[model samples]
Target: MNEHPFAEFIKILGKGKKGSRPLTQDEAYRAMTMIMNDQVEPIQLGAFMMLMRVKEETPEELAGFVAAARESFHHDTQTISADLDWSSYAGKRRHLPWFLLASLLLAENGIRVFMHGAEGHTEGRIYTRNVLAILGINAATSIDQAARQLQENNFSYLSLEHICPKLYDMINLRPMMGLRSPVHTLVRLLNPFDAAYSIQGIFHPSYRQVHQKAALLLQQPHMAVLKGEGGETERNPDMDCLVQSVHYDELSEENWPAIFERRHIKPEELNPQQLAQLWRGEFSDEYAEATVIGTAAIALKLLGKADNQQQAEALAQSYWNARDKERFST
Candidate 1:
């Protein structure tokens, strides 16, 4: 029997150390497009994902995969054009998602922030979707619904569950495979709405270049990738942040000093309700506040709302202070 079509793709990846090579841009695009369209067998798909994970993906390969994924999305430019695309895959294990508040603060100030994430694939962490539900924001089930929400609230969340279930299914394969696949990395780079600005968070430090370079390849007008707190695009205020970004097709890096002199200990138990209560001004936490402000400052600078870190921080604080306390009181 002739070798299966998918088997050829796997063989291309798994051919031995000296013989195997990274996929070209076009090949990567075609491979991922096939996977997205469910033309590949399940066993082959697993093998392909793990092989790419082990080898690590090149920026070209990542860009091509993102191209295919974006093409698969049925986004309408006429209806939705988000200013910021935030991807949240790594859940918070040490603290609640202060970045949720950061995104809301930006939205409150007229930035259209579209946030996407996947949940429940990994154990022992609280994800954005759960926290959003507690705060009375339901995840959008379709692109149109998300557009409507963004129109009304200036912020909307579309989960990988609906935005691209095939990719979400690939992410969930982590439990069965006992290791994360390439899906985790590329999913964050998927600017589903073709937003002008995108932000990414990575748990590992080295993946910063991978994300930045991939965004450049994808022609993202403005993007930032940082080593975020618990890897969810939420800044850790206790530590200085090195932001790798692409602005107008040029790549650059900046280091922002930590907001605090002394590092604060993470909360022992993450209380999701505190997210809403804090928004309602019924609760206050110093560490959480800094995270939100710091995270928002980075976004503010990326949006050109501020010229420098100091200005961005001041703007972020003002936005935070001016937020509607009762918006999520229910």
Candidate 2:
């Protein structure tokens, strides 16, 4: 009888605690490539995913997975000139996506930002795609559309479904699996367009070092990982943010002080319109405004626009203060 091609990868992970070990970079790359290409059977896929989730992926595994995922992209990533790649996978429950406004602020100031995310996997949370729609921004259904939108608006968002349908399906398996698979972690590192700079938000502080080390292995020129509010890239202005980054083959970390001494209360209701209102200067919330600025400030420092945190914060504030107050008006 012929052996199943994907079975080896599964066995490598599912071995007993003493025998099981994470896959090497090459093995992980091949395994993911097989998964992305639909060469693995459904049962094999399930076993592989769960085994990986239980073991937790290593930096080498994540780097390899990201490499395979990027290779699966249909578009010529070189053609897209994105200054930054922002990933928003974790939906917001306690706050509106102030990070969306932060990304827009960067885009408005001539930074070509590429944003990607997934939605509908979790209920009772606000996803980026839905919020973008409410703000009259259309998500790109294809890479070609995304490229065009990036050229036209300096900002574009492609959901996971459009980026890689296979991975999208895997992420949707969360409900059945009863826990998130490694796909959730690897997808955040995709950077499909090969953008020079990428920013990631994590719900867990431990993942910060994981992402930082993985980016280093992937040879990402510039990237930052933070424990953002609601697991999105938006900073929580009330708490000090520890940003771990990789720049030019070097790994570094920095701590940005909290903007407020007291934590702001979460709004009873999350109104998406408030995002635009705050942008237009029609609505003012100290917490929201600080969130937008602090988030962008980290991005600015990563983008080399500022030498230090203070300068980054000031630059972000200036950009926010100078934003087109009427841009989002109908």
Candidate 3:
């Protein structure tokens, strides 16, 4: 039957280590397009997923996958626009997602932030959409709804469940496959709305460069990837962070020193309610506040709201101090 269109993809990936190599960017784009369109056979899909998982994805492969995903979602430049595209797929295990507050701080200051993530793909961590609901923001069910929410609140969390069900299915395959597929990396790089700036957090430090390099290949004007706290883009106050970026078509790197000398121990229990409480000013935690400020400062700097690291932190603190405390409580 015409030699099964997708069989060659499996062959390219499944070939022995010596015989196989990374897919060209164009090849990656084509392969991912077929996957997203649900045109591959189940057997072929499984083989492809495992092969990619074992070897990991290269920057060119990742960029191509992102292009394919962006195409599948029809991320029109005319209709979809934001100041920052934030991806939060790695759920938090050691901390309450202070990154959420960082995003809010940016949104409060008139920066439109588009946040997207998937949930329940892995266990033992709290996902952003869940905490968002607890904090009184509903996850957007469609791109149209996400756009409206962004217009109203300057921030919107669009769940991958709704944004790309096909990708969600692949993420969910974690249980059946016993490992994560390239879908994980590809989803984070999607930036489906074509925002001018994009921020990403990776759990593994090694992938930091991979994400940054892929953004360069994608022609992203502004982007930053960091080994964030709990892999959620929240800066860790106790340790220095290295940020990789693509600034206006140029690649750069910067290191931000830790804010605290003493490391704060993660609480044995993570409470979602604390997120709203912290936002309402009814609760105070030194580490969490620094996390929010540090994270927001990076974003502000990337958005050109501040010229330098010191300026960004100062501006972020001002934004934090001026936030409407009761906004999330009600």
Candidate 4:
């Protein structure tokens, strides 16, 4: 039994209390050791998550948390070979998961993609890997294999289960705790590609700065952080979606942050609620025209195929609309 984990755990919970000092990295590390090692009781674990959520976490504060969580796992994906690695893990409660489809399209267009998340949805399994399987992409059975496949095929996926045993262990708590901890944030920052073009969908707006700093730390090539359908998943709501991106254009590893685009399309263009209700039933309705256009535009800009987003956005709408119509007819 690790006493350090328990000691840090107490400090976190205690700090969240009305009268306690904010827990530091040293403190969080000590606590997480016990929780990750299963030395803490369920009651204590739940209390810790709730208190931390109530108090909120800072990027600096999470440095220790992420470092500890990362120490326990090692992954190597040899299959994905692309300039950009697409990743997102802010779990979605509703709406059709467009990320899966978007990833497939990205892969089809020669961009390597990777995605992972625990089981979500009422059925305990609305996840990206499942969708990929449905689409005929085989997930990597091992870390090295995933790396090999990425080098060979340009895309691969490793879930929390594969990358970090302790974080995967926390899936037990999502049901009981009813809220996510810092692990959700960790998933987005954990890079699969050593150096590649990157696009990210973040859960919170505040994470923009966090991700920028993280990109610098990781020494990534380019990264885009988007607000994403007003705090919802990558559903392309047809109502709105805001994309904030950071580009690492050259030898310098500095982050270039910008609001790539503001999403203000008509919800009527796509009956989002209806699409969610009809998933797995049939491939119909051709999806939301405006949102498809917008997403395609971003994709175009990220590829550097277009000089400006305005032109890229226009092209995305028209190109996707035409493609959707063709797919539906066939």
**Per-model C-alpha lDDT, please?**
0.90, 0.93, 0.89, 0.55
**TM-scores for all predictions:** 0.97, 0.98, 0.97, 0.70
lDDT of 3 by residue, 9-76 (tens): 77788789787888889999999899988899888889998998888899999999988888877545
The clash number for model 2 is 0
Best by lDDT: 2
Off by over 4 Å in 1: none
Record all residue pairs in model 3 with backbone atoms less than 3 Å apart, i.e. clashing. Answer: none
Model 1: per-residue Cα lDDT over 55-111, one tens digit each: 999998999998998788766766687999999999989888999999999999899
Question: Where is the poorest 10-residue window by lDDT in model 2?
Answer: 72-81
Candidate 3 TM-score, true structure as reference: 0.97
Model 4: per-residue Cα lDDT over 198-302, one tens digit each = 666675668766666555545556666666543323436343445555567332221222333454433333333333323333444444433444555566676
Native-to-model Cα distance after best TM-score fit, residue 171 in candidate 3, in Å: 1.1
lDDT comparison, 1 vs 4, better candidate: 1
Index of the highest-TM-score prediction: 2
* Model 1 TM: 0.97
On the 0 to 100 scale, the lDDT of residue 9 in model 2 is 90
Off by over 4 Å in 2: none
